[model samples]
Target chain A: MIAKVARYILFSLWTVALATFAQAADFSGKAAVDTRFFTEPPIFAQQKDGVAYPSVMIQPEFRHDWGSGNNRLTVIPFARYDSLDKHRTHWDVREFSWLHMQKNWDLLVGVGKVFWGTTESRQLVDIINQSDLIEKFSGEEKLGQPMMNLNLPTDYGHFSLFYLPYFRERTFPSSNGRFLFDPPVRNSEGKLDGFSHWQPSFAGRWSKTFGDWDVGVAHFWGVGREPRLVPSFGQGFTHPPTGLVPIYDLIHQTSIDVQGVLGNWIWKAEAITRSGQGDRFAAAVVGFEYTKYGVFGGSKDVGFLLEYLYDGRSSFAPPTPFNNDIFSGIRVVFNDPQNTEFLFTNTVDLNTHATILGFNASRRLGEKWKIELESRFFANISATKNPFAPPKEILTGMRNDDYIQLRVVRHF
Target chain B: MKLKSLICGVLLMAAFPALAQTDEEKGYAIQAEANRRDNGYIDSMHDAVMTLKNAQGEVSTREFVVKTLEVADDGDKEMGIFHSPADVKGTAVLTFSHGTKPDDQWIYLPSLKRVKRVATVNKSGPFVGSEFAFEDISSWELDKYRYRYLRDEEIDGNDCFVVENYPVYEYSGYTKQIEWLDKKMYQPRKIEFYDRKGALLKTLTFSDYNQYLDRYWRAGKLQMDNVQNGKSTELLRKNYRFKNNFSDRDFTENALKNVR
Candidate 1:
């Protein structure tokens, strides 16, 4: 195939070019096998869900320094194999970038991923990359974007500019995957496959730290990473929200993230205002984590997290399970050789009387191995008073994807 | 008038740098001299291997690289990037220590691909699951503690100045610390930390001292033993490169974000 030929040519050239700086180059990466088990059959009868499935991922990173340590190059290539969701099996150039440093300015170019936010429960302001939803249900995994970025550090603030040449589309779960609504909405990848998807976008952020407070203000003008749904009712999907189409639109968004620390408490706040999607709307998340270190004279620390999430549109906004919710969690860290940690979170819906419970536990083995256990539980979902649960909409379908996942990771 | 003038001159002579002073002042002067001797090595970078053992005698190892830059007017800036243990690889911590004030610290989580500012108030807490507290690894400043010259004793075949000091920083976990410094090089050989209840909590031993660049001294190995839990962590340092070109920018949050 032509795609194969192009990939071979590109990789060959990249390798030849890298051979020049091979002496100072470093190689690092991780390999992981993840297995997930569904607690029950998916709520959607139209799905071909598997009770248990496995996935494997390999990520390798290469780095080299040049220009007398003033310039650097980094490349990370990643691939994943899935047993159930074929769409989840994918390859990506996670990072292939060169950075040049100057006295007060820095420049970076190529494909990269950047996260911008100061919240734990949700990352409302982190909009650089589209969500890799099929790989992880948390929506935290992202696809790399091709960009040219510049940064300036000053006495007042650190300013950054980004020019993204292409937009990456968000991946969705396959019908074979466990998580879905009564009927999964189709993701139209061909809608903007041509030059329409290559629209250039620009974004900028200014961040400053004063005393105990770290603040950032950002503006993004581009195709929204978050999708807007449009009604396409004639599809074969039988669910009410099922006929919806995921459409990305050009939008303007401004955001602010603030973090303040005092004693044992860290306070985080992130707010975003956006337009040109459906209607101009705002959303915010504020939280605080108070940690008690050396608990009871032991070598462990326990952190208590409390966060409140808000969506200005309330009932009219997109169906996010977290809207008008209060999140409470506890993090326990064991300062042992195993580097063990555990987190348990409970999200209480203020209006819908629903609860989303999540837990993650991780531990490191001798040297190169890590074991992680994670689970998500959707409980007490009466959805009777849910504003977004109008008739047969998809917002009332959180009970379908409760899963427990286990993973073993090996690093080289 | 002559008697008064003579008395005033004698008092001024007593206040001179080389004149007689109290034990407290002598202790401070000694610390200042040691600090002065260790000053002006612009920056340093080193690879480190940390070995940890539990009460059951099980052992584990971690690898990291530490880069530090010396600051003339304030505390030094240091950064540590973890390389091994799989789960925490690529995780980095940046610290900006202050003389007598609380340090500013941030940790970069590779999985999140984000940097989070951390409160350094819990200086006594373990660092990266290691037995070493953040306070233990921070830069040593002359004015961070109040010292007393306990006595001069022989330790490991070397004459050592045994000093007891209490941390001036309010959030420090130790009530006091007893340190044994070799008289010749003024290098710390051993230190014992006391808990808030004044009970012995742990003992730190430093050995295999290596002199780099002819003027700078670094302990090649440091061991911390916790008496309560019967756990210990041993750090072995190697490949020390000093006076490398490093700027203050190298230790800032910006560097943490950009560091490969």
Candidate 2:
């Protein structure tokens, strides 16, 4: 079914491009490389088997800016590859889409992937969408990550709508196998069943400024999947399945954000709530940021934030063990864009008492080239045994992890 | 006191136009000579300063470099801007060649800088926050405006011919302008501008006409006052070089970034 849909979308796009070839412009290319390291290796002891691995991702993108009289059409085609240790390599076409803009209206339609995250926090709801096979079952767990996708926008506001279909692979087993009672299930028969298609999702965000205040509201619905949760274990089970049961059939997520600047002080606050899933999860975040000119020889902007997240359900999940979580962090940014180093962030998890520190620096080499460097450290301070163990035993008791990344970019 | 009385009596006698046959012919000859000189000298100016002022009494100044390409033996020609402000300063040249459509042009900003090209049709729009637009600044030959001899007048102590000029451009911003041309130098001493609705808009005053090259008369200072806005622009010329060796190659897109 998914293959048929993908083929139809490709054929339609080709037909449109051929009809407009005489008016189309040339093509361009953009590429980037990103590498991330996990401080605490995956804990394998609790899960019986798991692997703690380092990862590297690379993406190459090509786009065409087509001319159509008073209208403009843009098509971006991209491919990505991720190397997780020596045993696993994940690759796929992440984004493919056509965007048309004319006068005051814009229309976008495609079938590859999508992204739906609008906040700085990684825990609450990142909800990036990709095929289960490409992410190594990471999309089912609700782990926030980048993806190629279809998006549409109009002149009404800075808001966009997106739709992403789901795909399945045979390698990663589903986490919901324990719920099924085995009746001498055979491996070949299980492969013939394939994977079930999850429901599509709808999300909308609207933001506007009133006087000195900037206000925004975001809402999301429908049941897709979240990749952050591990499969539950039972007293008796057979073959591991390839997907998990949807956590919430109808999840309604909403958030309200307000930001204002008073003289030299800047204040921002956001309150978010998720309901209609037979479970209620709420998070409130507020922070005050102050920027002073000519401070300590050079100008510096320092900000501190206090955030609290509460989960009425799933308090014992290995990743989130506390019902109430408190986080605080401070960041200092340099005022100058050229010949300046900026950004220092430190965060602490109050319930588990874990801490994460990060620093980033950037400099311009000349008119076209720029260089950037980033480093981060994560430390676990829990006294309890490793409840959250990865799939392999080699990742058990992961304590401290450090990562450093450097990048250089040139503009045309 | 006696010398002042004698001079006043002679001015009064000169002002009275006696119905004599010789005086009428003399007046007609003077008008013809003035018209001939004004037509030739108005086409030769290569650069000038235009100043504009607004309602709040704020002043703005702009310098224009006009290049003329002679097309006929009589010197009727096409003229355009060699330089301007904004990112369009370099290879962005505006030309007004002889055409049914006032003038045509092509501007090239540095492509390497991601700046795009703009055509000449946009010239009818306003010029960078000033009341004068691109069309107003472009060279329009004397014949482009329908002229009528109003009367003899005195401007800045010089005998002048006041002429009302109606623009022949299909879509000009102004309807008419009244000009006072000095009889001796053929330089415009003052000009009153009217909007498309026939409402008085601005008045430009010229002063300090100095001879640059024996026969050429140039205004050292020019001011444009917006009657509606009460603002004006004052222009002062300095270090103007004429007949300098300049060519079309200097205005090409490839040489934009390399120049200045």
Candidate 3:
């Protein structure tokens, strides 16, 4: 069967390669090794701190086009192996999609990906697809989503209309997985409030770029990407795992993003207001980056970044540490033969005084491999004072989860 | 020379109120004439292989393709997609350069699978770990610098006109640049860049010129040597195609992210 499938794929590709003006489809992917060291021991029930072991991932992609660059088909598959945490060992079809292009218009169908946002810290305005939470904590990884998108071009901007037929639940770690709740977070099933499984969601955005300004405003009306968990008491048992249930809420969100560039200065702003997720509330992130090239007359660059983040519902908001905070970061780039860079960031909570600092340094190795060193540390984290800690938030008890990570990626 | 000067005199007289007539203005006129002679190609696309060597003679190479569309009033729109050197094979960069304004750039990372809008602040930094700066690989706009004609000289048995240009844009790492334009072809044969300290830092050489449409000239090879670091980079051109009918839509961030 494997041989037959391989032969079939080769035959199809061979036939398409004969088409007129036909450029061969792109075939590419990567192999990666990711691991983490938990510094301290596990403080929670199922937490095993030390080293989480090495997890290996192999991903492959195939993208093909036909008929005057209008029709296209893409397929990507990912698989990983993990020694520890069963949740970390997984597989996914990141995208298997089709695209059709027309004059000043385009159509996208099947399982694809769409991202919308301008902020570096968080993408609050991107709500079409569910997050692949088990992948990482940075929220940069996403799962494939099924949708039919209609895009129209205008003189001033672009308008995108979306139709998402089904909702996807966020992935989570199992009871044996590392960095999870005491009794595990996943229940037997998902329960969404005021929405059904077959409900079709709708979303749209209008984006354009002026001489110095790039701006976009988007609106989403459907199931919320985030959830509110209702923990069912586990009889207060000491060991045997039992209960936590996630409740999905239907919501309507409207957002806007603006970015302006001037020589060495870049300013950005993202604001959002959402309804149906408790009460109507708003949030905003405003920031700017300034950089100096050839610092000290050398071929090095240093960029300073400052951002202010605020959420209307301070205490009542979700268990995130960024309700009212100041974020500052520094980026150093070595424009050398090795292509090395370092980034350091600090986010400080105004009300709770909880501070988190993250640092990442990356460099190219040889020609194919890239190595990244990352460290995240939390300071002044008080369970009573921290909104992101304990019974209020899933990670409240995980205040001590701060650790260092090293990952190596090889692109083929 | 008499007829050409008479025509130039008549033209300058009709436009006397707009520009000051001086040596600086004469330098600008010379450069503008060369620029206008190279205009109206519509668009172009090409492939390049870049090789770099260090002071110790260690060598590495990268492969990429570029699509550039010339705009009438503004600077050009360019997109570059890497093809080889596995670590950054699928990385792509889109740039929109304006005359005297800062450029807008976006980078697409295949790993994180997204497009990142990069703040174009360190344009003088190296390109792809090579000796060429980011601005060196971009389209040349006439308004970016102030020009002054130095003199005429002979290089490689060919008569050349020398001109010195000082960058007026902010955040540039170079203090000034001197260019040698071949008299017959009006093509840049060599360029010398001075550091911020007014010291000669690097020199660029262009050779193996090929003319498309029998009018526009393009170099098949470009080499930059960093005198300070004793390192060098060479760009060898492979294919050059013109008039591809590219539009603004092809250079947008959306198009950049979706390029397979």
lDDT of 1 by residue, A1-412 (tens): 9999999999999998768656678877889999988887766565656788889999987888877778989898889998977778989888999889987899999998888999888879998888887877668898888999999988878898999999888787776566553335467632441237789989999998787888999999988887654445453435334444567778899999999889899999999998875578899999999998888557788999999998764433345666688999999988777888999999888877677789999998878888999999887674324322342334444476688899998888
Runs with alpha carbons beyond 4 Å of true place in candidate 3: A1-23, A49-52, A181-184, A194-196, A236-242, A313-318, A384-390, B1-26
Across B1-260, the per-residue lDDT of candidate 2 in tens digits comes to 99999988777767864433253354344445654554434234346555545565544444455444433423233333323322122233534343334344334333221111223333334454455555555654544566666778997689997877776655556788888878888778998989867999878788877775566667777676778766566665444445533443333222222222
Among the numbered candidates, top TM-score falls to: 1
Off by over 4 Å in 2: A1-63, A66-88, A92-94, A102-104, A111-119, A122-195, A224-250, A276-278, A296-313, A316-340, A367-370, A383-398, A408-412, B1-260
> For each of the candidates, what fraction of the native contacts does it recover?
0.78, 0.00, 0.56
Assess each model's interface with DockQ, reporting 2 decimals per model.
0.70, 0.02, 0.51
Cα lDDT for residue B88, candidate 2: 21
The lDDT for every candidate, in the order shown, is 0.82, 0.46, 0.80
Which runs of model 1 end up more than 4 angstroms from their true locations?
A: A1-24, A189-195, A235-242, A314-318, A382-394, B1-20, B212-214
Q: Give the least accurate 10-residue stretch of model 3 chain B, judged by summed lDDT.
A: B17-26
State the lDDT of candidate 3 residue by residue for A1-412, as single tens digits. 9999999999888887646323576777788887877665555566555565778999887778889888988788888887667876888888888899876888999887888876667677778888887787656688888899998777778898999998887777666555565335774555787678677889999988886788889999988877765555455544343545667877789999888877777888899998876678999999988887777557788989899988874333344557888999999998766678999999888887778789999998877888998888777765534322335434544467677888898877
lDDT of 2 by residue, A58-172 (tens): 4433344545332333333334343443212444444454555443334455533332222233324433343343233112222222222222222333454544344332223
At residue A194, what lDDT does model 1 achieve?
A: 29
